[model samples]
Target: MDFDVDDAATLMALLDEKRPRRVTQSLLSGWDMLQTDLPSRERIESATAVLVGTGLATVDEDWGMLLTAEGARIRRAVPGRGLGMRQIPGILGAQLRARGVARADLTLPAALYDAAYSAYMEAAAHREERAYRRHWWETWKPRRQR
Candidate 1:
């Protein structure tokens, strides 16, 4: 399938909107907090790389992933855009909350991890489906008892 240019553009626009805000939210977590959050893993990864490459976000020993000062400044300057948190899947939410670290300040690391992991899972499922469609013998073979 062709990549969705519109989806990518939407993400860019959202980031641009946040570029001048004085928000305390990390960009990744902020993006996740959007009601119009990115629709696919590809878009999430691509947008993330773009933000990191542009110095809007950086990997930090303290923060894991964080919006740069400039990024936060830009976000502040932009007119306030309301951000809404995406509802985590029930089981995933429970697991994360159970870990005793479910604070708003910690949302970025959780969001980044969730995005990458979800992308990996989706890609793996796609690969397995393709292999099944192609009639890969291993896909059809009965599993050996452990």
Candidate 2:
């Protein structure tokens, strides 16, 4: 399915927050960062679907998801409304890395970028575990012989 503008906007805002980026966490954290109420999970899920479908992000069974190069470019290009400087520079670094760049100057500090990315990876791992447990029985159900 194509990305609805509102969905894309919400995802962009979440990623813009000054913390590790995750579909749900970004939505929850956005409330504090933007001083607005949190968005519903449906909305976040819809946005995530678009991001994944459009190759703007990647979903990991062990990691939540992170913005892809195309996603980062879109986020940088379209700054969120009323949210000044809502682009994550590390995503830019990611964009470069995706293109096989050895080194490049980034708008964000290396230390801050490293911290946020690391935090995101950790969060993704936890999310993956929870998801696995949530559906473990269904996945491990004994298969009937054909």
Candidate 3:
């Protein structure tokens, strides 16, 4: 019944699976700019492991990360339900019953989940802090202000 926000956030990210759009990335330079910033490699790996363990996602060495069918359905339904992240267990437990799955088969450890969220945020902040655009106009824009 009790759940941490950090844990829920991490679980949400696990549920929100993604894969590279190689064609789009190849065709458009701006694709990188529009993409969600990647979490640290360590964070991503750890999360991927957890996702795979939980049967929420699968990673293909060639294709990157993807949601399992169940994961995708849960992602679409649960995230937009307007429930607080802390209600993750409640919803997930409901899902188990609906799917005729054994609750004992799933592990929802708070410490493990919390670590993923914290690691991702830390990495993103470290990566973005003091960063600036590389375009020619970007170089001049700061000088123009001074």
Best by lDDT: 2
Better of 2 and 3 by lDDT: 2
- The C-alpha RMSD in Å for every predicted model, in order, reads 15.4, 16.1, 10.1
Cα distance off (Å), candidate 1, residue 73:
0.9
Steric clash pairs (candidate 3): none
lDDT of each: 0.41, 0.49, 0.44
Q: List the candidate 2 regions with Cα displacement exceeding 4 Å.
A: 1-4, 16-20, 23-26, 79-146
Off by over 4 Å in 1: 1-38, 60-64, 81-146
Candidate 2: Cα lDDT at 60: 56
Best by TM-score, which number?
2
What TM-scores do the predictions have? Answer: 0.33, 0.43, 0.37
> How much is 57 displaced in model 3, in angstroms?
0.4
Counted clashes in each candidate structure = 14, 0, 0
Q: Tens-digit lDDT track for model 1 on 82-122?
A: 53223222222233233322112122344544655566557
